[model samples]
Target: MKIERVKSRVSLRRTIESGTEEQRRAVLEIISTVRARGDEALKSYTEKFDGVRLDSLRVTNEEIEAAYQNVSEEALRIIREAAENIRDYHERQKRESWIIAKEDGTMLGQKITPLDAVGLYVPGGTAAYPSSVLMNVIPAQVAGVKRIVITSPPNKNGTLPAGVLVAASELGVKEIYKVGGAQAIAALAYGTETIRPVDKIFGPGNIYVALAKREVFGQVAIDMIAGPSEIVVLADETANVNEIAADLLSQAEHDERASAILVTPSMKLALAVASEVKKQLETLPRKAIAVSALENYGAIYVTETLAEAVEVVNELAPEHLEVMTAEPMQLLGQIRHAGAIFLGRFSSEPVGDYFAGPNHVLPTNGTARFSSGLSVDEFVKKSSIIFYSEPALQRNAGKIAAFARLEGLEAHARAVEERFKK
Candidate 1:
C-alpha cells in the first residue's frame, strides 16, 4: 500500500465495467435465442458453459434433502440465524398501502405492492455464496414477493452447491434452477418452457450475466450493475493499526480491482498501517490477488485533520465506510455518502457482510453518492393512489384545465372537463 498526503478531497471513482463489444453481441444473441427457443436454449447453454447436461432445469425436492445431508448441522444453524437476523431487519422496512382523505372527499396516497416474482443469480463454481442467497432473498420475502427463484450454475456432477441449497431451503425458497451465466439471465427475463420470466432479477454473477442484465433492463428490472468490492476506513490515531490493516485486506482479497483505503490525519498512523498491511498481506491465502489490489488501488491517505479525512471519505463515497475514530458515532451525521457504515472497532465490515442483518449487496465503485444498498424497497413497487369527488373536481377543474392547456394538451384538459360537461 502506498502512503500519500492529501491536499484536498480525492475521488476513488473507477470506470464502471461495460463488457466488450463481443460480449455485448453475445449477450444479445443469447437473450434473443432464449426468447425464441425457450428451455431448449437454456439447456444448450447450460451444457455448453456449465459442462453439465441436465434432464431438467429446476432443482427437485429430493435434491434439496440431499443438500441438507451434505451440509453440517452447525452450518445450517448459522445460516438459519443469519436468515432470522436479515428477515428481522427487513421486516422493519415493509410498508403497507395507505390513503389520506380530506373533508372534500379527495383521497390521495400510495399503494405498495410486492413484485410478483424475482430471480436471484448466485455465482457458482469453487466459491459458494450462501450469504448472497440470504441477503437477496430475505428482503424480497419481507416485501411479500410471492415467487422467489434461485439460479446458479451446476457443478461437474450437475448439482448446486450444498451451502447455497441449504440457505435457500432455510428461507423456504423451493424454485431452484441449475442454470447460470447470460443464458440464465435471459431465461429470467424471457420465460422458458420450465422457468417463468420474473418481474425483476437480483443477485450477482460474471461479466456475461451483467451484460445480459444490461441488455434486458427494459423487459425486467434489475439490481444495479455492481462493481468490485470497496472499503474506506476513516480512522484516527486512537484506532488500532492491526485491525485497520486486517479490515482493508478483507475487501482487497475480494478482487484485483477492489479498493481498500485508510484516511487519517496522523502521518505516523498512515505509515504504520501501510507497514501493517504489507505484513498482513503476506499471510493472506489470496495473497496474489490482494497484492495486485494493494499495488494498484490500495492507499493510506494522510490528512491535515480528522475533519479533512471525513471530507475525503465523502468524496470517495465508498461502498463500505468504517469509522474507527475515538468516538465513531459522533461523526455519523457528517457522513453523507457510503453504502454501509461500520462504527467503532468491533463493527468490522465483514460483520455487515455476513451476519449484521444489513444487506451486503451494496453500491460499489463510488455509486454510494447517488444510490443505496439492496433492501426491501428494491423488491416492491409503489403506485400513487388518487380519488377525487365531484365537489373536489369542481373546485379545481378550471385550474387543472388551465394547466393542461398551458402545455397545449387539449385531450388532457378535455379528459378532466369531460366529467363536468353540461
Candidate 2:
C-alpha cells in the first residue's frame, strides 16, 4: 500500500461496468432464446456452459435430503444460528398496513404487500456462496414472500454444492433449481416448464448474468448492478495498526478490483499500517488477488486533522467503513456515507459479513453515497391507499379539477368533475 497526504477530496469511484458489446449482444440472444424456447433453451445453455446434460432442471427432494447428509452437523448448527440472527433483525423491518381515518370520513394510508415470488441466483462451483444464500433468503422469508427460488449451476457431477443446498434447506426454501449463468437469470425472469416466473430477481453473478439482469429489468425487478467490494478504515494514532491492516485485507481478498483504504491524521499510524498490510498480504491464500487490488486501488491517506479524515471518508463513500479511533462511537454522526460501519477494534468487518445480523449484500463502489444495503424493504412493495367519502370529494372536486386543468389534462379534470355535474 502506498501512503499520500490528502490535498483535496478523495474519491474511490470506479466507472460502473456496462458489459462489452459482444457480451451484451450475447446476453440479448440468450434472453430472447429463453423467452421464445423456454425449457428447451435453458437445458441447451446448461449443457453448453455447465458441461452437463440434465433431464431435469429442478433439484428433487431426494437430492436435498442427501445434501443434509453431506453437510456436517457443526456447519448446520452455525448456519441455523446465523439464519435466526438474520431473521430476527429483518423481522423488525417489516411494516404493517397503516391507515389514518379523519373525522370527515376520508381515509388515507399505505398498504405493504410482499412480492409474490423472488429468485436468488447463487454462483456455482468454486464461486458458490452459502453465506449469500442466508443473507438473501432470510429477508424475503421475513417479508412473508410466499415463493422463493434458488438457482445455481450444476457441477460436472450434475449436483449443486452441498453447502449451497444445505443453506437453502435450512431456510425451508424448497424451490431449488439446478441451473445457472445468464440462462438461470433468464429462466427466473421469464419462467420455463419446470420453473415459474418471479416478480423480481436478486443475487450476484458474472458479467453475463449482470447483463442479463439489466436486459430483463423491465419485465421483472432486479437488485442493484453490484460492483466489486470496498472497505475504508478511518483511524487515528490511538488505533491498532495490525487490526487495521487485517480488516483492509479482508475486503481486498474479495476481488482484484476491490478497494481497501486507510485514512488517518497520524503519519506514524499511516506508515505502520502500510508495513503491516504488506506483512499480512504475504500469508493470505489469495495473495495474488489482494496484491493486485492494493497495488491498483489501495492507499493510506494522511489528513491534517481527524475531522478532515472524516471528510475524506465521506467523499470516498466506501462500501464498508471502519472507525478505529480513541472513541469510535463519537464519530458516528460525522459519517454520512457507508454501506456498513464497523466501530472499535472488536467490531471487525467479517462480523457483519457472517455472524452479525446485518445484511452483507451492500452497495458497492461509491454507491453507498446514494443507495443502501439489502433489507426487507427490497422484498416488499408499497401501494398508496386512498378513500374519499362523498362529502370529501364534493368539497375538493373543484380544486382537483382546477389543478388537473392547470397541467392541460382535460380528461383528468373532467374525470373529477364527472361526479359533481348536475
Candidate 3:
C-alpha cells in the first residue's frame, strides 16, 4: 500500500486532484454531440458504448413487470424494506414554508415548494445498487416533487436491472429510460424528443457521468460533481484494527480509484490495520479492485495526538469519516467537515449507505467543506414573502426613503415617499 506520513498541504491537494484535462474534454464533446443530435445520438451511443440496440429509450410497463419476476423475492423484499427506511428518513427532513406576524401588521415569511420535475441517474455497471435508487428517489418524493424520472443503461440484452426497476416502481416513479453515460446526462439536460428535460438531475456515476454533470450544470440542477468514493477512519488505540480494516476495504472495493485512509495516533493500530487489510483482501470477491485501490490510494498517517488526527481529518474533508475511538462522541464536536460522520465502533459506513436512512449520495473530493449530502433541501426551493400594512409602511416610509436616497436612487425613495401621500 502507498502509505505516506502527514506532510504539506500543497502535496495533499495535488494528490486529491485525480482526473486529467483530456478526460474532461472528451466528456464535454460527448455531451455536446448528444445535445445536438437528441434521440438519434442516444441510439448510436447506446449501441457503441453499451453494446445494446434499443427499440425505444423508454422502459415499458411490460419490462418493469418482467423485472419483478426476474429478481428473487428475497432481494425484492430487502429493496422494499430499505426503501421504507429511506422514505422514513427523508420524510422527516421535509420542510414547510412559514410566516411571521410583526407587531406593526407586517407579514414576513417563506414559501417552500418542490421542483416541477427531477431526473435520477442510476449507474449500470458490474453491480446494480437498488439502494442508490432508493436514496436518490425517496428524498425527491418527500420534497413533494411532482415528477421523478429515472435513466439507466440497459443490459447487453437491452433490459434494465431488476432490482433497480423494482426499487423505482416501489417509489411510484414510472418514467424509466434506457440510457446511460454522458449521453443520458445530456438527454436529461437538453430534453430529447422522448425524454423530457428536468429541473434537476441527481445520482452518481463514473468519470464520464461526473464530467457530464459538470458540463450540464447550468442547463439543469445537479446533485453534485462527484468524484471517486473515499473513506477515512479516525481511530485510537482502543479501536479494533479488524473492524477498521473491514470498513476501509468496504469503500475500496467500490472501484480501483477509490481511496481508503486511516488516521490514528497509535502506530501499533496502524500496523495491525495494514495486516488485517491484507488478510481480508484475499477473501473479498472484488479483491482485484480493492487491492488496486489500497495499493494506489490507501494509507495510514499516525499523529502524536487524537486532536492532531481530527485536525488532519477536517482538512482532508473525506466523503465518509468514521471516528472509532474509545470516546467517539468526545471528538464529534471537533469535526467541522465530513460528508457523513460515523461515530463509535458499530456505526460503520455501510450502515449509512444501506439502511441507516440518510441519503448516501454525499459530496465527494472535498466538496463537503462547502456542499452537503442530498436531502429534501436539494429538491425544494424557498421563496421569501413579505407584506406590510399601509399603516406599517407609512410608519417606516421615511426611514426607507432616506435609505434609498442615500443609495442614490431617487425613484426608489419617491416610490416609498408617494405611498405616504395623504
Candidate 4:
C-alpha cells in the first residue's frame, strides 16, 4: 500500500463496468438461447463453461446424502452453529401482516408475503466456501420463501463441494441444480424443463454472471449488481498498525479489483500501516492479486483531522468500513455510508463476513450510499391493503370524485361517484 497526503475524495468506481461488450453480448446470446432451447441450452452451456457434461441439472437426494459423508463433523457443527446465529438474527427481521381498523369502520394494512421462489447463485470459483451458501440461503429461509433453489458450477466431476451441499442440506434447501455461470442465470430467469423459474435471484459471481443478471433483471428481479470487494480502515495513532494492515489486505486478497484503503489523521500511523501492509503481503497466498489491488486502488490517506477522515469515508461509501480509533463508538455517528461498520479493534471485517449475525453480502463500489445489504426485505413483497365501509365511502366519495376530477381523470371520478349515484 502507498500513503498520500489527503486532498480530496478518491474515486471508488471502475472507469467502466467490469464486463466488456463482448461479455455482455455473450451473456445476451446465452440468455436468448436458454429462453428458446431451455434445458438443451443449459446442458450445452454447462459443458462449454464448467467443462462438465451433466446428464441431469438437479442435484439428486443421493448426492445430498453422499455429501453429508464427505463433510467433516467439525465443519458440520460449525455450520449448524452459524446457521442458528443467522436464523436468530434474521427472525427479528421477519414481518407480520398488519391491519389498522379505524372508528369509521375503514381498515388499512399491509400484507407481507414472501416470494414464490428465489434462486441463489453460488460461485464455483478456485475454491468453494460454504459460508456464501449459508449467508445467501438463510435470509430467504427466514423470509419464509416457499421455495429456495441454488445453482452452482460443478467440479470436473459435475458435483458440488461437500461443504456447500452440507450447508444447503442443513437449511433444507434441497432444490439445487449442478449448473452455473451465465447459463445458470438464464435457466433461473427464463426457466428450463428441469429447473423452475424464480421470482428473484440472489448471490454474486464473476463478470459474465454479473452481466447475465443485469440482462435478466426485468424478466426476474435480482439482487444488486455487486462489484469487487473493498474495505476502508479509519485509524488513529492509538490503532494497532498490524491489525490495520491485515484488515486492509483481507479484502484486497478477495480479487484483483478488490480495494483496501487506510485513512487516518496521523501521518505516522498511516505510514506504519502502509509498511505493515507491505510486510504482510509477502506471506499472503494471493499476493499477486493483492499487490495489484494495492498498487492500483489501495492508498493510505493522511487527513488533517478525524472529522475530515469521516467525510472522506462518506464520499467513498465503501462496502466495509473499520473504525480503529481510540473510541470507535464515538465515530459511529459521523459515518453515513458504509455497507457494514466494524467498531473497535476486535471487530474485524471477516467477523461480519462469516460468523457474524449481520450479512456478509453487502453493497459494493460506493453503492452503500443508496443501497443496503441483503435482508428479509429483498425476499418479500409488500402489498397495500385497503378497505372502506359503505358509510365511510358514501361520506367521502364526493370529495374523492372532486379530487379525481381536478386531475382530469373523469373515469376515476365516475368510479368514485357510481357508488353514490343511487
Candidate 5:
C-alpha cells in the first residue's frame, strides 16, 4: 500500500472518484433497452451476459425444495440462525404510525405504511452471497412489504445457487427469477412480462448494477448508489498491526476497486501495518485483487494526533470505519461520518459483513457523508396526517391563505379561504 503524508482532504476524494465513465453510459443504454423491449430485452441480455438460457424467468417450488436437499441440515441451521438475528435487529427498527391532537380540535399524525412489493438483487459475479439475501429481504419483511421478489443470475445448468435459494426460502421470498445484471434491475424497475414491477429495489451488485439503480431511481426507490466495498482503520501504537492488516485485506478481497486504508498517529505503527499487509497477502487466495486495490485506492497515512486522525477520517467518509486505538470509545464520539463503526480489534469488518446484526450493504465512495446503510426505513413510507376542527380552521386559515397567496398560488389560497367562508 502507498504511504502518503497527511496534507489535504481532497487527496482522498480524488482517489475514490476513480470509476470508469463507461460504467455510466453502458448502464443507461441497458436501462433504455429494457424500458423499450421489456421481457425480450431481459431475456436477450441474460443470455448474452450471464450465459444462461431460460424458458421461464421465475424459479419453481421444486427447485427451492431441491436446493434444501443440496444444503445439509447443519448449513440450513446456520442460515436460519443468521436470519433470526437479522430479523431481530430489523424488527427493533420497525416503526408504528402515530398521531397527536391539540386542544383546538386539530389532529396531526404520521402514518407509516409498507410498500406493496420490493425486489432484491443478489449478486452472482464471483460467488453466491446468501448473506446478502438475508440482510436485504429480512428488513423488507420486517417492514411488512407484501411481496418480496428476488432476482439472481443462474448457474450453467439454468438453476440458482443452492445457498441463495435456501436463503430466499428462509425469508419466505418465493417470487424469484433466474435473471441478473443490469437486466435484472431493469426487469424490477419496468417489469418484464413475467416479472412484475416493484415499488422499491434493494441489495448490492457490481458497477453495472449500481449505475442501473441510479438510472432507475425515480421509477423505484433504491437503498443507495453503492460503490466498491471499503474499510478504514484508525489505529494507535497499542493496536495489533497484524489484526488490522488482516481486517483491511478482508474488504480489499471484495474487488479490485475496493479500498482499504490505515490512519495512525504513530508512523511506526503505520509502517508495521503496511509490512503486515504484505506478509498476510501471500497466504490469501484473493491476494491479487487485494494487492491491486491496495496499490490503487488504499493508503497508510500518519497523522500527528488522534484528533487529527478523526479529522482525516471524516474527510475520507469510508463505508466501514474501525477504531482499533488504545481506547476505541474515546474516539467514538469524534466520528462524524461512517456507514458502520467497528470498535476494538475483535470487531473486524467481516463480522458485520456476514454474521453481525447490522446491514453490510453500506454507503460507499464517500456517500456516508450524506446517505446511510440499508434498513427498515428504506422499505417504509411516512405520510403526515392532519385534521382540524372548525375553530382551528377559523384561527389558522387566514394565515394559510395569506401565505399561499404570497406565493402567487391564488387557487391554493382560495381553497383555504372557502373553508372559512362567512
Candidate 6:
C-alpha cells in the first residue's frame, strides 16, 4: 500500500454505487416469478440458486431442536449475552403513546405501533453469520413485534445453518424458512402458502437482495438498500498504525467491494499505516478479497490538518468511523455524518460488529450522509392522533373550511363545515 499525499481533501473519492443493469434485471425476474408462483417459485429458485430442492419451505420444530443440540454451549451462551446487550440497548429507544391536551379542549397525540410481523433475511453460503441473525431480529423483538420470521439459504444438503437456527430460536423466532436470494424477498413481499407476507423486511444480502429490496419497496417496507460495507478512520499521529490497519481490514474482509480508508494529517502516520496494511493483508485468510478492495477503494491521505481530515470524513460519510485523535470526544462534535462512530484506540470496529449493543447493519455507500443504521425504530410505525370537542370544532371549523376551499378541495371544506353544523 502506497500512501498518497494531498494538500486538500477534494481528491479522496471512490465509486460507491456499482450495481449493474444485469443484476437489476435478474432480481426483477426472480421477484416477478416468486410473485406469480408463490411457494413453488421459492423451491424452484432454491434449487436454482442454492442448488437444493426442499420438500418444504418452512423449517420444523425438530430441526430447531437439533440446531440447539448442534451448537456448543459456549457459543449459545455468547449469543444469549449479545442478545441481552442488544435488548437492553434497544429498550431505551422504545417509545410510549403520548397525548397532549390543550386548554381549548382539543387533544393531539401520536401512537407508536410495532409492525404486525417482520421478515428477517440472513445470508448463507461461505459461512454462517449468526451475528447477522441476532442483529436483524433482536430489534424487532424489542419493538414488540408479534411474529418474526427468518429466511436463510440452505446448504446443498438442504439444511439451514445450525448457527443461524440457534440464533433465531434464541430470540423466540421459531418461524424459520429454508429459502434465500431475491426469491425469498419476493415471497416475503407477496404471500406464499407457507410463508405469509410481512409488514416489513429487515436484513442485508448480496446485490440481488439489495435490488430485490429496491424492486419491492412499494409492496412492503425494507430496512434499507445497503451497498457494500465501508469504513473510514480519522486519526492523528497518536493513532497506532497496527490498530488502524487492523480496523481497515476488519471491513475490507467483508467483500471485494468493501472500502477502508485512512484520513490523517501526519504523512509519517499515513505511510506507516499503509505499510502495516500491506503486511497484515498477507496474513488474512480473505487476503484476495481485501486486496482487491484496497487496490480499488482503499487510500491513505495526508491532510493539511485534522480539521481537513474531519471534512473529508464528512464528505465521504463512511458507514463506520474511528476517531483516534488526542481528544476523540472533542472531535466527535465536529462529525456531522456517519452511521456509527468509535472513539479512542481501544474502540476497534469489530467490537461493535459482534459484542456491542449497537446494530452492525449500518447504511453503506455514503448513505450515512442521509440515513442511519437499523434500529428499534425501523420495526415500528407512527400514527398521528387528533380530537376536537364540539366547541373547539365550532371555533376552528370556519377557518379550516376557508383554507380547504382556497385549495379547491370542496369535499374537505364540506367535511369541516358539517362537523360544525352537526
Q: How accurate locally, in lDDT, is each candidate?
A: 0.92, 0.92, 0.87, 0.89, 0.87, 0.87
| Model 1: CA > 4 A from native | none
- lDDT of candidate 6 vs native? 0.87
Clashing pairs in 1: none
Estimate the lDDT of model 5. 0.87
TM-score order of candidates, top first: 1, 2, 4, 6, 5, 3
TM-score of 4: 0.97
lDDT of 1 by residue, 267-385 (tens): 98999998898899888899999999999999989999998999999999999999999999999999999999999999999999999798999998889999999999999999999
Better of 4 and 6 by lDDT: 4
Candidate 3 lDDT at 56 equals 95
Better of 2 and 3 by lDDT: 2
lDDT of 3 by residue, 37-58 (tens): 8899999999999999998999
Residue-level error in angstroms, candidate 5, position 288: 1.0
Candidate 1 vs candidate 6, lDDT winner? 1
- Write the residue-wise lDDT of candidate 2 on 3-43 in tens digits: 99995498999888998999999999998998899989988
lDDT of 4 by residue, 282-377 (tens): 899999999998898898888899988888888889999999999899999989999999999999998888887888889888888998998888
Residue 37's lDDT within candidate 2 is 94
TM-score of 3: 0.93
What is the clash count for each candidate, in the order shown? 0, 0, 0, 0, 0, 0
lDDT by residue (tens digit), candidate 6, 1-422 = 55777654443335545379998888889888888888989999998888988998889898889888899999999999998888788888888889999988889999999999999899887878889988888888888899998898899988898989888888778799999999999989998889999989888888788788888988899887777788889999998889999999998888888888899999989888988898998889999999998998888877888888888888888899999899999998999889999999988998898888998989877778789888889998999999887789888888999999999999999997876563
Off by over 4 Å in 2: none
Clashing pairs in 5: none
